[model samples]
Target: MDSFDGFVTGLREQLDGPLPGTSAQLTMAPSYRMTPEQARVEGKSCREAGVLALLFPDGSRVHVVLTVRRDELPDHPGQIAFPGGQREAGESLRATALREAHEEVGLQRDRVQVLGALTPLYIPPSNFCVHPFVGVTAAPPALCPTDAEVAHILRVPLDHLLRPEARRREPWTLHGSTVDVPFFAVDDHTVWGATAMMLAELLAVVRPLYPSLTIPS
Candidate 1:
């Protein structure tokens, strides 16, 4: 897969530069997208967090890790998400991302090569302003899930994300209101909300490099 390697190189270069940002994030956003004005309104009241899109080589392809949270969690219960949580005092966003990944899935910080950061997303339901980072390792890390937080772990191939069919929309009920939600369907998981939105930006950045890989607008 020479083309895939080229795509990864291109993605690394793009991440080093300016990101696609909000325009890209909006592509996979829920019906009611949160605005910067709203985030500012919440201001110091909003929680700050970081998530890692930890990628690794699997056989002949590259894959990223995602987790399904336990239902007992107070926030975003039983939802698909990247490994992350609220930032600890005195920790940088990058450190927070790596630390959370280590705790949630046993992905050690030393194994990850921090690529770059993605656009910050604001989640209205949880009142969290999340900063997402992209990282890669040579091979898949030994994933040991923290039972209290993670219900299951998924290793989604990058190629799957680039497929046009991976993106789908369905009606879902949230907070007593039914809304048409777009998501990335991987295996048996329906990834939506902030996690999907963040992934949209990543795909947008890499899609152009491989014209054959159709990514939903």
Candidate 2:
């Protein structure tokens, strides 16, 4: 937890108070290892492309807003995930993340100070390529979730994420196969997969600014 304490202080000092720019943008490409033949055969079965936003609030606190998908959704049903969805016609990946954030949660584009984007990440089970965007919000947001698609909204603190103890690798067994999932145990919830990957990148950026920062095991 000492490492996490250092991380929190560093994040607050670096990003807290007034920021220099109104917004920034980054293009991220996150890769995954999947069976190529299976990918070709699946041809994007349940495959999708989406985006997620990282919002920094007051103090050294950074909040990652995730959603509980409506049980009715055919894929990724009821899972806790970053706010995003499949790309729409004529939409760039950035547009998709922003648009989805607005539709899924009541986050307006105007309120978000988009810092940049991260690499794209692929999910094999769903065959998705997700684009992640990072933003620093000036104020805490009041979320209004669309009841049909979102059941609950989760806010995870960045400080907690940097704690090494909060980090672990969990093994998942599915379809007679096993995979190691990087995870962060926060409160009563677990953050993993693309979400965890994005967090890792975020920590990499913020941790260096403050050397005391450490990502949980």
Candidate 1 ranges beyond 4 A from true positions: 1-8, 34-45, 72-74
Clashing pairs in 1: none
lDDT (Cα, tens digit) per residue for candidate 1, span 1-217: 4644565687799898888888777777777774545323245467899999988878877788999988889877878999998899999989999999988988879988888888887777777889999988877788978647898899998889989899998888988999889999988778998899898888877666656665566
Which candidate has the highest TM-score of all? 1
How many angstroms is residue 67 displaced in model 2 relative to the true structure, after the best TM-score fit?
A: 1.7
Per-residue lDDT over 45-94 for candidate 2, one digit per residue giving the tens place of the 0 to 100 score:
45456667556564666567878777789876766777888898888878
Model 2 misplaced stretches (Cα beyond 4 Å) = 1-48, 71-73
lDDT of 1: 0.83
lDDT for each candidate structure:
0.83, 0.62
Q: How many angstroms is residue 103 displaced in model 1 relative to the true structure, after the best TM-score fit? A: 0.5
Cα error of candidate 1 at position 27, Å? 1.3
